[model samples]
Structure formats: structure tokens, C-alpha cells
Target: MKQDDTTEGAAESTDAFGGLTPAEGLELLRVGELTVQGRLAAASNATLYCTVSDGLRSAACVYKPVAGERPLWDFPDGTLAGREVGAYAVSEALGWGTVPPTVHRDGPFGEGMVQLWVHGDETVDLVALARETDNEALRRMAVFDAVVNNSDRKIGHLLPTASGHLYGCDHGVSFAEEYKLRTVLWQWQGMPLTDDALTRLAALRARLADSADPLRQELDRHLTGPEVFAVRSRVDLLLRHRVHPYPSPDWPAVPWPPV
Candidate 1:
């Protein structure tokens, strides 16, 4: 992990995690002991801020216990934690670090989703960033949200790090069977897919087509059969259209409390 000079209102610097590699970070998160530090009172669910340690290594993380999830009418099949993990799987498979390193594990509360904490660059205006059309990372994230059918891509979920990397969180309501991509990132809507996006989607489509693909297997572990299938279907649709999806006329184009 690397540290940035600007850390005024940031949660914790990236270097606070002890310069762990992605594999090491994931391993620590998967096996380390969790100690609750405090609760994120702003979240709708029971989002706990904690430190995960395996004695030798440790990092700050957010823990969302399945037992603490608030039920939603639209997504009733699986636990929100599972959906969070599923969303991480999609992001990772695309080779996009849009979502932080997240895993499903047992914690003090119960089985839930645990993700590496990101300290966003507080200097960036999220509202302005969400509406930017020239950002490559944001464009990739928009495609990702479309694939996952993310229903809650609030401006607050955008985690623009001081290191210039962008990540998103609160994916508990994603992977719905219906087309419910309500996001503030519609800047690329109806535009031709970027060359990078086209290539990545093509690769993702092939991987999802294979049942033995690890990505598909991981998705199955969290999402239902239909939900997983819906993911593949969504990817196929994107590749077929070769363009950014338009906001659905039926569903609200953006989430409530956009920030």
C-alpha cells in the first residue's frame, strides 16, 4: 500500500494496511480475526468498521453481517452479504478494481461480507465526478453497474482514492433478475462502447459461458441460479449491443438521495 499526502477527511490511508499485495490482502481478510471498532451509522444496514488481522498482518475493513441486513422487497432470495460478494466477483473477473477486495466469511456477528476499507480522496466532488464524461475509470464502472444490474449506485458509493484509483461499495442490492440499473453514471448512456470495454466484455462473455470458469463458480456460490444466469445474460446483451445501455424507461434512472 502507498500513502498520499492528502488525508484530511479520509478514513485511513492505503498504506495503513502495511503494503500488502492483493493476494495477501484477500488472504488476510479471509482468515484474519475481526475486531469491531465502530458502526457506520449512516448506512441503512448494519455496517461495522473493523480491523482484520492474522497476527502478522492487518488492515481496516467494513463488515456487513447477514444477520444485520434490512430486508428489501425487490431482492428477497439471497442475503445482502452474498450479493455484495457476488458483485465483487463480477468486478474482479472483469479485471477492474472498481470494487475493493471483498470476501464472504464468518465474523463476530455471523457470516457476512468483509471488504478492504478504502479512504476516498475527500477533495473530489462526487456529484461532479459522477457526471464527468471523460473519466475512463468511471466509464468502466458504469459498464460494471450495468452488468450487475446495480440498483443503488449513489454518489456516496463512489470511492475515489488519493492514489487515483476509483472503487465503489454498497452492492447489496445488485444482480436482480430484472433490469434495475439505477445510477448517477449515465454519462455514457447510448454511446458506443469504448474499445477497452468491448474487449473486456467479450472476454467476460466467454468466461461466463463456461460453467467451470472460476468466476461463474464463484457467482453461483452467492447468487441463485437464475441470478447468475441473469449476469451472463446481461454480459451477452452488452456485447451484442456494443453500446452503453440507456436508462430503463420503466425503472427510475437514478437512486433516491443520489449522494
Candidate 2:
């Protein structure tokens, strides 16, 4: 997907604080501008962290990047920052529930974005949370992930807020528009769609049909037209082919473990 779009120094960073841990990342901050902090959570190809700014006085920022992440394929640089920004922007534009404002930054660490921290009372476990899958809210959450082409959404990424609203994190690999719908939400398969759920999908369909106008401009450019149509097809398929068992728990993890 044109991962080669940016080269080193092409995208700038405000400041560089190298090799910081999640705890350490919270300590470093600057206000008004985005700052590159230390690595937070590391996956096969990316790290999660709090991009800090001292002036802001806010301690923690949460984001996932493929900074040290390796090439999943022959094309494009596998770095996380730029790709996440694209996917996040696209998802946001399509009017889905997604990460809050991500600050696109130019910095020494290369191009990347910062995500608003999701406050979860405890660590997330999909199977555990699956217990609550029947709840309309949770079901909607899974379905949203599916529709967004959110391939990296693991059970771990769904944070359970204190209020019980499940927040999704790490969406770098979303919006490919083909073979991109990945997640574990089949537990509610065949469950009748609430008016709200059906409405959300219907609304998304309305947006996609207007792809000439573009529901998400970023996706319009990044994903091919046919691919975007495929995405729409998958969404329709999910609603139609879906069985009562919910998503087949049999699907293996999205190949990229963490966004």
C-alpha cells in the first residue's frame, strides 16, 4: 500500500527520547506539540506507547506502531506510524467508533501518530469478554471491528472501560477493503440484529455506495475501488451469511498480532 511513501527524516519528530518503557514514557511529556517517547508495548512489528509532551502535563498517550516491526510483505516499509494514521483517519471519516484524535507527527523517529489513551479497569481477555458478547454493546463492538477491516483487533486490544464501554485500540491494518475483515465475534452469530446494529451497517452501506464521494477519502486513495467494493460486500456477507454460533472461533489470529 505504498509503504515506501516516506523515507527517514522526510517525516519529522518534535523530540526524541529513545528506549523508554511504558512507565517511563508516561514520565516524559511536552505540551502543544507531539513528542516521541520510549517504546511502550512491543509486538512482532510494532510498539505501543504514550507519545509525550511536557507542556501538556498529560502523562500517558497510547498508540501502536510498526517502528521496529518487520516486513509482513515485499511492498512498502512495514513501519507502523504512517499506516496507522491512514487507517485511523479512514475509519474516523467513515463515522465508526474508533480511537480519538490521532496527532499526525513529523519527527526523528519517522512519521507516526499519537492516540488517546483508553482507560480500562483491567487487562482485556477476549474469551473472558466473549462472555459479555451477547450484550448489544459488545456485539456492536465486534461488528464494528469487522466492518472497519480492523485486522489487528485482538481480545487484548478491546479495553473494558470502567463504565463498561469497550474501547478498541490499534487499527493500522484496517480498510484494505478485501480479505481484511478479521476478528473473533462469531459467538453471537445468528443473533438477531438490534435496530441499532442493523442501522449502523445500513448506514455504513449508504456511505460506501457513495464511494465516488467517498465515505473515507484516505481509503478511497489507499485501497482500490474494487477493494472498497469488496469491503462493502464483506459487510453485507457478514450480515447475511452469519450463523447463530457467532464468528467461528476457529479462525486463526490476524497474521500480524499487534498493530
Candidate 3:
């Protein structure tokens, strides 16, 4: 699958797995201002860093194909372009400090996921960051992610900013109502959820119909109904039960390509 970059919105560029190029595939990135620095990692698929123009701003970007391009167990459609964008959308709203603002860019050259460039150090885990928080916001990030039905969040996806803040990446496989809660963030696997976190879960459930909802389109048909309910229940569970991180074994052990 190939990727494309379009300053125009991706309204016309929608497709199964966001419609990668038939031939050029990875090479279609020549039109962008950002140059391919290097291959970050190659597990689920591929990832690369490049320059991108979002709205009126320009910044470095991580580019990669939508889920349909790669074959991981989590994404049944093999593509969750809509869902990945949804996760980023919600993350940005709450100032989660985890997901950077993301957009779906496409054009004559390439098409796929394009997100704001996050310039910072990639260190620190949720547990280490959780220690410093009084409200336990660190632990809540995991619960919030799970409530959103994040399907893939290995250790490496969580990064530390130079300022000591924690950030999350690689949520393309999120928002499925089933057993998609898989991550290494559950150090205290059986911990209870805080009141504030519970509220956010309700907010997310209420916002499930958000016309701008990113996951609404990408969420699988098999999971469409339950997935929406899952979002509601996951929020309730985090609010009611002390849901800890479950074992993410069948989950892919490799890092998602950082494109």
C-alpha cells in the first residue's frame, strides 16, 4: 500500500484502508516538504517521518498507511483510518497531552495518516510518570485508552516529553467494543478508576455520535453496535470497577511503523 499527502481534506480520498496507491506505494511521498529521515521501525508495517502542512501551519509529521495496508490481528478490516483519526480527535480535545492533532491528507501523490510533528524526547513510561501525579492521571491514560477501545499500545507507544510529560502514540487499532484493551500500561492491573476518569468515560460515550467522530466510519461492521456500547461500558467499568490492564499476548509484540 502507498501513502499520499493532500492539503485538502480527505473527504474525497476515503476508501478501504484509505486507498493506498496501486503501484508507487511508499514512493509517493516525494511531494512533501519533509524528507524521509530514516526507517523508525518495521513490525506491523512501515513508518517514516516527513514534513506536512496542516491547515495554515507546517510541521514534521509521522506518515503511514491506514490499517487496511497491514495485516495485524486487531484491525479486522485491515484498515482503521476513520477510527485512528477518531482516537486522535478525542485525545486532542481533552488535552490528553498524549495524541498530537492529526489529519487525513491526500492528493495526486500520496494518501494515509498525517499527524502533527511532536518534537521531544521519547522516554519515560506511564508507571514512572504516574508516580509524580497527585490525581493519578498517568494511570488514567491507560483506562481512557482502553475505554476508547485502544487495541494496540505496546510499551514503546508511550513516550516522555523533554519537559517530563508523557505522550501516547500508535492508536490506529483503537475503539472496538470487544476485548481490544491491550497494553503494557497496566502496571497496577487491578486498580480502581478515579471519579474524574469516570466522567471522561461518560463524555466519550455521549460523544459517540459526534459527527466529527473519527472512529464512526472505521469501526468494523462486526463490532459496530457492540463497539459503541463497549465505549459506554468501558467508561462505566473504569468508573465503577477497578479495571486493570489485561494481558496483551495475542497482541502484536512488534512496534508499529512510525510513519
**Highest lDDT among the candidates is held by which one?**
1
Per-residue lDDT tens digits for candidate 3, residues 1-259, read: 1111221232122121123321122223333444455546653555666654333334455766553256656456644555656676566444443565555555323556655444445343444443343434456567657767675766556554443444567777787655656555556566666555566666766565564565444333224666667666665666566456565576543334311
| Winner of 1 and 3 under TM-score | 1
Clashes of 1: 1
Candidate 2, poorest ten consecutive residues by summed lDDT: 1-10
> How many clashes would you count in candidate 2?
22
For model 1, how does the per-residue alpha-carbon lDDT over 128-176 read when each residue is reduced to its tens digit?
8888787777888899999999999999999887666677999999999
Q: Enumerate residue pairs that collide in model 1.
A: 1-19
Per-residue lDDT of 62 in model 2: 50
Number of the top TM-score candidate: 1
lDDT tens digits by residue: candidate 2, 11-93: 12112113332233333421234544666644554455654556634545654443555665522465345546555544444
Alpha carbon deviation, residue 97, candidate 3 (Å): 3.2
Residue 182 displacement (Å), model 3: 1.8
> Which should have the higher lDDT, number 1 or number 2?
1
Q: Report the C-alpha displacement of residue 2, candidate 1, in angstroms.
A: 15
Q: How many backbone clashes does candidate 3 have?
A: 18
